[model samples]
Target: MDTMRDRFAPVMTELLDEDPRVAVVLAEIGRDGLAEAARRHPDRVINVGIREQLLIGAGAGLALTGLRPVLHTFGSFLVERPFEQVKLDLGHQDAGAVLVSGLGSYDWPAGGFTHMAPGDVALLDTLDGWTVHVPGHPDEAEALLRHAVAAGDDKVYVRLSVQTNAEARPVDGARFLTVRSGGSGVVVAVGPMLDPVLDATGGLDVTVLHATTVRPFDGEALRRATGAAGADVVLVEPYLAGTSTAAANDALADVPHRILGLGVARRELRRYGTMEEHIAAHGLDPHGLRRRITRFLDGAARGGS
Candidate 1:
């Protein structure tokens, strides 16, 4: 729905009004939608029209001057095109910002690969000090947004889109909240993957853990939850498959473990269609995920490679 728009506009405006240290940088998007906030604050809400590099550069400059800049745009334009700027401008300068992106994964399938960014999170993982968040619901988004903005000196990237869970779950900056408990395995659902993960594990005896704040992943919590059975872990993410494989390994170190990673396909479909179509092809839909997870769990139980 309008969760993407509403999350940016109203919450941003409120943050701007309450915090003088906050500023906005737009890459030709959300400029007019926040016109009044720009008018009210004059120099804070900047519309850097289409120049993605300059948009990030400007945000870095603002941060250097003791202002917390919140940059907004679609995922590809915000992170991919201007990635060098994101690295050199903010990272090199040792600056921090809240880079909030809209239209995640294939949210804008009509716009083609140029508009979609399934690798943004993986890219951010390369850098230091970034806290990536993929909110599953509007409430989770708002809470995470407020927390990121208030943090001021933290480097945060929030991916917002139309995909959402049916309801909200308890959220924190660096902890995985358990949604269901069972002995067979643990299904870690990141962001909107909660719905599909839940559906896939419905009949299976497993533990389900939810996470909106993914990066700096809740490794400690993960260890504790899976300690008893040392059960299987099925990480279902909304971005690239196995992006957090290494982190999962580190978290489960010192114990024998197995993990099945599910996410957006690394290979492109090479055809444009609806989000549902793309999801089905990638085996991310509930039914598709269920089949894959079921087979994996069964094979693992049988001691098959």
Candidate 2:
């Protein structure tokens, strides 16, 4: 059971060897993992030595030349620190690249709040034409990574994290997979939140849908799952809470619905503890989730908004 980041290196190295149009730009992180690839193809596998902006800039430059570039770094530095460059270079120029991020919202609690990027997806939401993939397992990560690189000229974000499900669900790079069917409500579990969501929703009459590609958000699938007016939806994500709530609201706009967004909260915890502690603090663990989800569902059923 390798971590998503652990699988990313070798999969990327293989992609570099197979595709002449594929390139990787790094910012001094994950260098050791892809060192062999860098040695094999110096021009294609590049490390910009801790310059986040340059990492994106170089990837953008490669994209402009018609080569697919995959940018790698921690979520905060990759998306937040160099956001201006991402906005102008990729979005403004219409150049496309694959931005693969590691160390999700609170994967490394000791790394401090600076390393945690709960708003990465939400920030990308401000931009247009970006595909975001949040894979729950290493295998799914590889699948999504290959799909993004092969898509060519499409801006894609593949978010990788240490938090993973015990098993890998089938991922087609798009569309949410229905894990369970129930009549009361639908629980949309994104990426690594699947196991916790399933655990939390145990015995509850709620349909569960697993999402890997979240940007193009499968509203149609959600529509099918709920199948009636005034549906109740709980989005269990590993990033910022309510990040996808608006998207869900828009998806169910025509119908009356209630949504509960659960994930990392807005405030910084500021304390360095175990990742499990952070999870518990954010109420994202199975125990907290069960309590919250049950309460929400109960309220909705009782005619409470």
Candidate 3:
């Protein structure tokens, strides 16, 4: 199976090929991959050196000239280093550009924390008019990209990862993916962690929600899903506890949510390893999550309160 990165590049290439107006701005590292596509389809890609700020600014400029610009770069560099440029050039101008941010979270293990962007959601979510999409799989990424390209108004930030895909049921709307069916409680999982959630809840009557879109969430659908699973809800995310999930819990005040998060001790990681190792180290492995969910289900069953 192709990784999300491998799958996404081709879809983007196809889109650029079919549409003459669509042009790609490839960062230094991404240039080779995108350049090959450009070569095959000539007239679609613009290679920019390793300048994050300039890359976005130029992309915004391209959008102003009636061209669709898709900017590609490392997630950390795109959001962290080019903060001002992205905010002023892209967000402020309401530039219709798609930012493909690669290696979200610890995807770039060898790149270290400096290259890891676990806070892209919190950072970009604050910007007005910017749509932050954290897709769980390649299919969702392709679908979301198609939607964003056709949108033609808002700025888009796609936080992509090399993580393996979860077996999520195809999403029909902008709502989250409901993994396990239940009428007792809801567990809202962020990103690819939905796979682990399903593994954890083997025979339990708990509903698992995979949140594909982090911003501009489908409130009506969320309410319906949580309501269907009763009032008890638990939010699971790889990010810090008080970020998106916390804010969402506050917004849905009527439904009580138990925010289960990665403990504070594992917040700023120092070592390098695979995603599985990191997840295990932080007690997010299937066994650990199973124990937690079992406890929650047992408690809910005992009182039915």
Q: Estimate each model's TM-score.
A: 0.98, 0.98, 0.88
Where is model 2 poorest over a 10-residue stretch in terms of lDDT? 223-232
- Candidate 2 C-alpha lDDT tens digits along 1-305: 78999988999999999999999999999999998999999999999998999998889999999899999999999999999999999999999999999999999989999999999999999999999999999999999999998896899999999999999999998899999999999999999999999999999999999999999999999999988675799999899999999999988898888999999999889999988899899999999999999999999879886
lDDT of 1 by residue, 1-305 (tens): 55744778899999899999999999888887798899999889999898999999999999999999999999999899999999999998999999999888998788999989999999999898899988899888898899899885889998897888899888876788899998777789999889988988898998899988888888887887789457688889888999887898889987778999899988987788998898888899899999988888888889984
Model 3, 103-189: lDDT tens per residue?
867776778888877777667766887776777777777777777676675688777777645553565426676667787677777
- lDDT of all predictions: 0.88, 0.93, 0.71
Residue 118 error, candidate 2, Å: 0.5
- Predicted model with the maximum TM-score: 2
**Evaluated with lDDT, which candidate comes out highest?**
2
Clashing pairs in 2: none
Runs of candidate 3 with Cα error greater than 4 angstroms are: 40-44, 166-168, 228-230, 255-258, 261-266, 294-305
